[model samples]
Target chain A: MKSAFTRNRPLATAVTALVGLPLLLAGCGASSGSAGSENVTEISVMDYYNNEPDKSFIGDALNSCAAEAGVTLKRETVPGKSLISKVLQQSSSKTLPDVLMLDNPDLQQIAATGALAPLSDFKVSTEDFAPGVLSAGTYKDKVYGLAPTVNTIALFYNKDILAKAGVTPPATWDELEAAAAKLTEGDQYGLAFNANPTYEGTWQFLPLMWSNGGDEKNINTPETTQALQLWTDLVKDGSVSSSALNWTQADVNDQFLAGKAAMMVNGPWQIPALSKQPSLQYGVVKIPVREAGQTAVAPLGGEVWTVPQTGNKARQAKAAEIVSCLNSDKNQMSMAKARNTIPSKTSLAETFAKENPKLATFTELVKTARARTGQLGDGWPAQATKIYTAIQAALTGSASPGDALKQAQGQ
Target chain B: MSLAADLSPSKAQSRQHGPAVDQAPLVPRRRNRHRKERLFQWLFLVPAVVYMALFFGYPVVKNVIMSFQDYTTATFFTGEAPWVGVQNYVTVLSSSLFSTSLLNTALFTIGSILGQFVIGLALAIFFQRKFPLNGILRSLLLLPWLLPLIVSSAVWRWILDKDSGALNRFLGDLNIIETGVPWLTSTSLALIAVVGVNIWIGIPFNLTILYGGLQEIPDELYEAGSLDGATGWKAFRYITWPMLKPVVSVVLVLGVVYTLKVLDIILGLTNGGPANSTQTIATQSYALSFQEFKFGEGAALGNVLVIISLVFAVLYLRASRRAVDE
Candidate 1:
């Protein structure tokens, strides 16, 4: 046995060397191949519009933008949840796509990594963009990305159910609670909003938290607790289903569409699906504030286009042109109309709201919408996790709203 | 000439058919042939060794190295992960969630293994009897194992949904309760619900292995036990159990190891939610790395899990060895 072991040592070393050689060579090859010629033709783009109508709608927009930029398009669409991880992987491999689309909240984190080149470097104009949109795409005051269209959560009420219950569309917390209590009956929940243990839950809770004067930087304060209390009371009173603790925003939309929920807090992205039910008349309103006079501040939701540092200067420049074209007023208007989103430009949004009155509330909400990462920057995900954790704790009856927030903040 | 005489019949026949070798070099020729034979044996093992090193060894070593570094999202782009020694382990072990996750991992593994094994063994023994359509029934039992875990979890999610799930609807019809049971929603019940789904997924695997073990038990032992007034319960105790001990140890060890790293079912069903009632070390590690981009902490937790699995594996080796000795 000893002799046999000694005999195999050389073979083992040979195997290790053989296995490692390709990996080392491959790394060198990847780095060297990225610095290509100046006459770039097919610029690659990556985004997370992997699902339906939005996929085709965004595809057409990108193809047209590529045409305008005098380059053929090579586009890759991933599922929304996987986009960030994919970006990190590609960044490490030095194969990051020329044009990258990130969820606005994620722009700061990616920008912090220096993987994204600031759009200003390519002479892309940020003029006429909404403050919230600009803030979402900005890191350390340098604009790294831009969203052509943006969206925010709002109160989506089922018209027939609200009419049947004789409850008005709520505009304040008091009215909302009263209206929800009145509408809840038998098998139907009065309101549906996700409080799941995910970032989506934090996004849904932001309208209430921000409008109530809550700050993510210091969530243990009274204002955030009050917002959490509102969520807790609704679940406790059975106005909202206890199952909201597990429901995603998509699930809340489903509950509303099935008439199991009289109202839901969701984004306008649900409009296409809701429109399919022609008989189901639904109206959108800004998410209610704590009091009558306070403004409703919803968190901005959209995908921002940016140029990634792919080591090819010409391609990066061409990619920035496509991003600028996508955010052009004409393209923004067309994309917003097709995608049921609010245009990022303040003037275009006003004209868009005038043309499509159905999106007026969303347009109005966008004016005062806040970017989640505006205050926390790359640190936003940690705070977002804490917020959702607190929501789950309070809603699950494990702790009081204040205690849950305090405990989460302490973590 | 003497070496040729010592050769096996086949080798000697081949040598006779080939060109004749010089008598003076016979000893050296034999030693050269022996060395070539040894090299050929090692060459045959190359693929398996390379595969194990590349897949299992590389990832485990990489995770260990990452655990000592301040690896994060920035590290991906910058390629600079400063070594932090034991700081990651210290943080991960000291966190409030660590104890909860440890306790939850223990409960999840014990509950799943106990439920799956007992149920599996019973089904395996029951199927030992002669019954019509027995083969088809046993094959049907393997369906749960055949389905992808994600697919199974998705189906179970619908079945266990609070308001409109099939389980609630069925229970409602039977007047089990007035309201829907919040199977996947309640903090108190979410863990159990996740465990139940895991158990269902694991049953087929346990049953298939235990059933094969049971088939290997000689019927003659049972026949002799019956003569000694040991029929049903007595026969199983005296004949089947002692013989099935080795397989039982294997099944339990494998089940525990698999259950310790369960992520997908818990993720798909609840995402370690309802206030993290279902959060195990595996899911928490996943959240740390992918969700929070805290790769260092995630690798630390993952290493802790690997140590636990290694402990079980050691015990399994000892137990199997004891079985062999017996």
Candidate 2:
């Protein structure tokens, strides 16, 4: 050989480079593995449920049920800050957990994504589940998710702060704004809220939009603009701090518990957390209306259990079993007790109320509470992003509610 | 160090531009000798090449093809693509948000590059010579760069929080400021805050690279220049500046490419928010893909991102050559 060294040098280098590159890459890359259905007897249920340290909670009860049912359960509990993003990411990979818990309106979005597996395998209907709870998961005439636990918005007031300030809970936005101004003082913000578009901006503003006599689907209407304008006025009048947009729902609950703010628009989920706080002297009521013609609105919020249609019969069957367990009356009651949610079991409202007194007003509000305009389980993300972002933008002076909604809807 | 090489390549591809088929054989024993050499070369390269072709190259081509088809994951692996050619591209190009992302990316890149270069160069020159705790200081300068951008941006998010944040906390404590500024909540201030974070992150890399270049300049040159009536700023403008040109070009080109593709920082910091003020193309692409449930549109966004970065690379390379010519 005229020289093996000279002849193979370039070849060896190239080969080494080729082999080394793959080895290096293999050692350090995110693998998009095929989601195998083999041995998938168990279903993973992820919830936007916040974990409590208590010995008994909704998450723990669910785990106990899974243990009782002899099925594997992957329980994921996430904070409000990362919940939506985590759900979205999991959905994109077709690795959606078999069960999910979150606001009902989001289930509508997931259904629209074709991510929430249809409940066809289980063949459950709206009649099989609680009214309004099942509506968020029905798309194209197919039901997708089942709500095991549900909670909707309610106006929360610090009884101690308001009582001390000699103010009554306001029934209308104008009175609420007035109460806020009266209560606000040195280093004490009057009202606490979360104005995040995907979070409070959607949940809190939905009621405002409804109070102003605007429909969720028609979010860019003049009434919606006026509703947003009212909120903007609150910000300008110094009744509500502009910083609320960045506050998380959990964060607002903390501020309320700390007695930092006089009143806040919150939901039933805060009941268990707040009830234990020694400084928490709060009462729940209907979300305030802005006009006499309008009624207070509480945006529909809840969770759903689902089965993804990945075309694997065995996998689908296992997922369905998980969903069935989730929808069972026993599980629903368990979830309600642990999650501190409004029982989706219509029959248990009285029981839930007697056990948790803070939930009583929210229950009353639910009678008139506005279900999100995603009856077909569609159009909320597109609409809410427009409605809520506009409301926030107007409040922050990024746009007039009129212009913000107009811009958001691309009108 | 954490950022060094943590990406899993189990499916990563190794790419190569092979010699043409008409290449002359090695002298005489080039045939059998070549066979053995080729065997060894192929043996080593086979794994990486196969990995790349399977994972990266194949997926890229597949994704591009998928972009043209009206398809989802369900449709793609089913052995056929319903080719509705150019529909995805049409949807993206027609969308107004695409244009916004492009404009935002441009603004973000240009603004950050200027800040990184000027400030990085300053720090680099400042740290050029030996000093007390020189090694310690150089290592400490790498802290922001060394930490994951996720951790950095998360920390920055706390600092920029409108309430109970470090920035507002410090400012209020000094009594120099009366009210807490909404560093991120404001539409006008959101982008600026994210850019400020990006600049903070980008400075260390530039400083490290430029400092490395600064060290290469012999100390005698500066001493000789000082003797030749070149002192202080004058010495740097003459001997130091001309010599550092190659390294500066490298930093600019490298920095531009990397910053233009930045996704995590912008996402973690603002999410293109306060109404899309901080929205970059990558985050927008991510939003389109996951949030909006439009994978084709998302892929189109990635394509646009790739095209934009390619253009930046070409332009920077041209500028680098021009500098060399000058």
Candidate 3:
């Protein structure tokens, strides 16, 4: 019995090795089977429009585009946050979809991986697109993606509350501070914005930071410090809720809708949800600048469509056609109108703004909007992290604005 | 024991056969029988061994290998992760945030375990009494565990909201303070609040296990102790405490392991915010890999966490062995 027990131990280990080897081989085998084929009748697409309105709108556009290109569409939609990881996983497995939709900021990071095939390779035209949109899609002077429409953050305020408080939408820093303070009352803060520790927080802070002459390249500068100080002062003086530190953009919208916040810094995407409540009389304006003449340079917010390097030339050509079709002037206008975003083409902007008057502020902001990844390329995430860290530290009163910037910069 | 019983009968039959046959031939026949028995034993263990290797062993090995390389987003496409020796480990360990994450991890784990175990034990003991709806109450206590972690975190987020949360509203109704408490927003209070929520989620697991242990301790000992003038605290000290040690060790060790790598609760609650006061090693590792795309440093930090868990596992093994010996 003792001999049998001892002998069985090694046999168990051998069996484990035997089973694991086959499983590994099987994984490799399955991935290899997905390699390029000659005849391509179906074009696979992946995106992050998993929610309503945008989902149906984007899905309809994709289906129409696929029909235009004379191919069947196999589209997969994931949650917003999981899109990048899913793309990376699919890239490594050599199973990346023919067309992949990436958030504008993430396009550069993924393109740097050599996983995306540049649109230039297929001679896709990007003429008449907004400069900011083009810059967002360009990495290393090569355009890898194109967005149909884009959006930017703006100050959204409740008309009823602001009228009762006798305050106009603030256009400059001092007016903003004064209006916020005067509007503060029981159970209602004057302003709400996201300052959580994530990329969303960084995106929200960018308008204030950039409008004040701060640059992502060096956030420790005095301009950035001043921007940080404004956020700190807003929280310190009780004009903004201390809970803004934990609220997401969605939560900020909820606070605005529930009348807990009189004003919010958000984007046009909230228009659908805001319109659902016909009782809500809201208006949008540019996020305020430090001085009146300075432009409120908010970061451009949107997703870009790109063809991944799936090693199938025929499918990639078809995918590029579909992507180009999705960005056509007609589709862009309709998508922007339906989705409440500004069309990516400069020519379409005036018409879009005229049609959707509520998005005029956003369309105006998009003209001077900056792409988060445009400056840093693939190195943007680290700097974005530092910005939000400094925001958190300064707002939480753990460090002064200047000191927080310096500390985060050092990190 | 069952294996021994089967082997003994076979050995006896082999001995009976050996006398009727030639001794030289019987030796080979017995050896053949022994080989068949060993093969059968190995076959019984194959499924479990294969499952472990495929699921547990492969990922661990892959992670360890990844920690030594300069893995990044580019590596996923190009499939080239150049060797960087221990550079990833050095960078992660030397970062200022690493120390903070480590300390927060220690505090989060310790606070969560202590609160869960103590409260869980108390509840388990209380339920040991005869009562109407005892079973129903015990099962109801498991609601937190049954609910998804993200759902619970979201509910807790609203409940602990500074301005409009249920908790602050209650506190305000009682006139405890003028302002709403920032349960999840303040740097000073975030970690504590996270630990409190974790403890609530963890109680059901500890209670179920400890309650099972409590049941296994025969009532005869308690009755005899009572007859000897031991009751209440004395009866528990003498009769219940010693009997519960093994189960207590198991629960504590398991609790520490689970709590050490907790990610979803913290991510949903705070996302390691308010100056990263609530950032733990698990969350930091996740941020490094997924958020920043620094897979090498993430893998290194993950390995560090695995080592910490392994230390506890070894200690538990030693303690359990010693308990068995006694």
Docking class of 2: incorrect
lDDT of 1: 0.90
Preferred candidate (lDDT higher): 2 or 3: 3
Candidate 1, residues B237-280: lDDT per residue as tens digits? 87889999998998899888899999999999999999989999
Off by over 4 Å in 1: A1-32, B1-25, B323-326
TM-score of each: 0.93, 0.83, 0.94
lDDT for each candidate structure: 0.90, 0.71, 0.91
Best-to-worst DockQ order: 3, 1, 2
Q: Please give the distance, in angstroms, between residue A142's alpha carbon in candidate 3 and its true position after superposition.
A: 0.3
Chain B TM-score of every predicted model: 0.90, 0.82, 0.90
Candidate 2 Cα deviation (angstroms), residue A202: 2.2
Record all residue pairs in model 3 with backbone atoms less than 3 Å apart, i.e. clashing: none
lDDT of 3 at A241: 95
Specify the highest-DockQ model's number.
Answer: 3
- The candidate maximizing lDDT is 3
DockQ of every model listed? 0.38, 0.21, 0.48
Give residue A174's error in model 1 in angstroms. 0.8
